[model samples]
Target: MSFRDRTHAGRELALRLVERAGSGHLIDVLVLALPPGGVPVAAEVAGALHAPLDVLVAGEISTPVRPETAIGALVADDPPLYDRRSLAMMHLSEDRLGDVVVGERNELHRREYLYRGRRPLPSVNGRTVVLVDDGLTTGLTATAALRFLRRHGPTRLVLAIPVGNARTLSSLRDECDALVCLQQPPSLHAVGEWYEDFAPVSDTQVADTLHAFHATA
Candidate 1:
């Protein structure tokens, strides 16, 4: 079924996730969204679980030749950066690794400034963190987010999304403690294809959603 919008997708995905989670016991659990697409969906998930919502700043490094193809990803303030092997396995070019890194870093900085302002990042140490997104296609951003979460010492890391491609889902299975996705289409096109309304989420929308969720919590 095609989602009416990101908000509709979020509600549906959150219901499925809550069912899969098998309980509504997310007492201290945190929902970390990979913006700017992930924010709306993550807000719904956080609301459903009655959990605190946080933002995980990251960006995808798309291949120069194939802009739709993700070369790699970069997570802000994370150590033990992803290696070339990871990129190569994804069919990314090692020759353009430097360029990819530089571009991704610049985007990451802009995203961080736009979404975070002067607010400090939340602590995920020894807590159950539900990393959320609107959908997963290449899984590059999800991988980077998982790696960053690991470094921050989350007791359990769950990667959650509304929709995902089969290959991307398969690749991410072993990366996180658990994977919760609503749809996994075999012949995936783009992340926006499955939804009826897949508008590009803005930084202001993300901030407003975060604040609204926090206020209600």
Candidate 2:
């Protein structure tokens, strides 16, 4: 199934989570989005669940040749998570990606600071943390974000996405308490293929989304 856009996909995703919440699967919920693509999608979720919306900046590491590829992902100051198979196939090593990691890490920090000024990440201990993203391709970034959240002592961690690759979604099942994916095609060539409007989300859009949420919250 294709989505009209991120907003439409978000509303649809929220319906599934609301069912989970109704079943008592969610408690003391806190919605954390992986910006900037995840912001608008998550805004709908945070509103539906009456949960606070926030951002958890995670950066994708890729080589200059294939910039769209995600060889690894990093969150906060934690160690980067790499796809070993992908690395081996590409004949690349973590050491070789040092410069890429540094660049992505810097961008991650810049995004975090831009979306959230001096404010620190909200506490996840004993709370049900829902990490929202637009969609998952390799799922490296979501995996990295989930691992980072896992260390923070959350009571339950959930990963929600509108669409993703079936195999990739299955691989991430162990990372969170629950996984909500609307469309899991046999093979996902590109995430944009499943969305009618897959435009790049700007930094200004991310900032404005958070600002609007906080204003009401």
Which model scores highest in TM-score? 2
Q: Which residue pairs overlap in candidate 1's backbone? A: none
What is the C-alpha lDDT profile of model 1 across 1-217, one tens digit per residue?
A: 7788888888987897677557743436899998888898888888887788879988766655667666567788553244466566666555647766776788778777777677777899988899999888777778888987888888888998888998879988888888888888986778899888898998899888877776776
What are the RMSD figures for all models against the true structure?
Answer: 2.9, 0.9
Q: What's the TM-score of each model vs. the native?
A: 0.86, 0.97
Candidate 2 lDDT (Cα, 0 to 1): 0.94
lDDT (0 to 1) per candidate: 0.80, 0.94
Candidate 2 lDDT over 1-217, as tens digits, reads 7999999999999999999999999999999999988998999999999999999999988889889788889999999999998899999999999988899899889888999999899999999999999998889999999999999999999999999999999999999999999999989989899999999999999999999988988
Cα misplacement distance, residue 4 of candidate 1 (Å): 1.0
